[model samples]
Target: MSTEVAAEVVVAPPANDAEEGTKQSHKLERKWAFWFDTTKPKQGAAWGSTLKKAYTFDTVEEFWCLYDQIFKPSKLTGNADFHLFKAGVEPKWEDPECANGGKWTVSGSRKTNLDGMWLETLMALIGEQFDEADDICGVVVSARQRGDKLSLWTRNATNEAVQMSIGRKWKEIIDVTDKISYSFHDDAKKDKSSRGRYSV
Candidate 1:
């Protein structure tokens, strides 16, 4: 039996004009699923059971609603991770859409304000700001004891041109001066110490 819960699909209500004549809702370019995972899991529990679908949202208002309800990366202690991916794509590397993909990762110390960075990354993803938007799969933030990590996952590892474009745009969006590295999912799974295929 699987413990994974189905993602909840939320449709943004039709925009309505207020007394001031302004539209009330802003729709996103795509629907996104928010996933949460904690450091602790049941002994002998399947990995999927430990990773749960938290919510799915397609509007700016809904995104804020869900974000407000979830724990911020800074508040998540130990090995916790937050993943925001396209509605149909699971965050795991094995997912068909992500199997051949890679990620561009940026790390910051505990003192860094990761919550803001994560939020900005999400906005960029939903806004389709990347030139290689089609190559994007999602974004993830991992909270660790030593330092935190922010990564943008893309759909093709072999497509260097697409992957690099996404990476460069991501760096610009996040406004980070630090160099970020890109690594294939397969390479990461094989050896954590392996060097990234590209960096910016």
Candidate 2:
């Protein structure tokens, strides 16, 4: 996506306003924004400069419509990343909503069914399935050469109980028994090879 197409807020027509037999678009608890970062960065490009806000949607129909097109996370290749965050939150470490946050990450390989996991995470997010929804910030799927990765970002890094609960619940949602690790954005900033502060 390009800057010219970014930040387009999409609030679907209300169910009451639809035609006599038209289907309704179910509204989500909160508006969510989609962002995309290209697979390759140009030489000397500014950090996050390649990121595009994409769009913001507050209904089920809009989410599916967009997902089938540009947002098919599994279609992303190379160093590309697809981010889905609460409407006002930027998918960047410096954003106030994410500055002190950390993420619970699950690495994915060739047989990991990345696409299925992506859809499951997206639905859980828009459906507000987490018990600690207040601490949730966003989710990201990074497609890389070594392998793909899915990470659920949270609003606080030091909140151990909340983080653990989230990690456990997410594992259940994605139906994975593999250990998922949580690491702080601050820690990641300091050490690219940083270890997880907690695991579940």
Best by lDDT: 2
Off by over 4 Å in 2: 1-21, 110-112
Q: What is the lDDT of every predicted structure here?
A: 0.78, 0.83
Candidate 2 lDDT by residue in tens digits, 1-200: 43333333233322342455567768899999888886466889867888877777898877887786567665665788889999999999999989999999998753557888888999999999998998999999988888789999999999999999999999999888888899999988987865899999
Model 1 segments more than 4 A misplaced: 1-23, 42-46
Could you give me the TM-score of model 2 versus the true structure?
A: 0.88
State residue 152's C-alpha deviation in candidate 2, in Å. 0.5
The digit string of per-residue lDDT tens for model 1 on 1-200 reads: 11222232223322344435765767898898888776467899766567877777788877876666553677676787889999999998889999999899998654676877888888888888787787889988888877789888888899988887887887887789888889999997888654799998
Q: Candidate 2, after superposition: displacement of residue 182 in Å?
A: 0.5
TM-score for each candidate, following the candidate numbering: 0.84, 0.88
RMSD, candidate 2, Å: 3.4
Q: Candidate 2 local accuracy as lDDT?
A: 0.83
Superposed Cα deviation of residue 36, candidate 2 (Å): 0.5
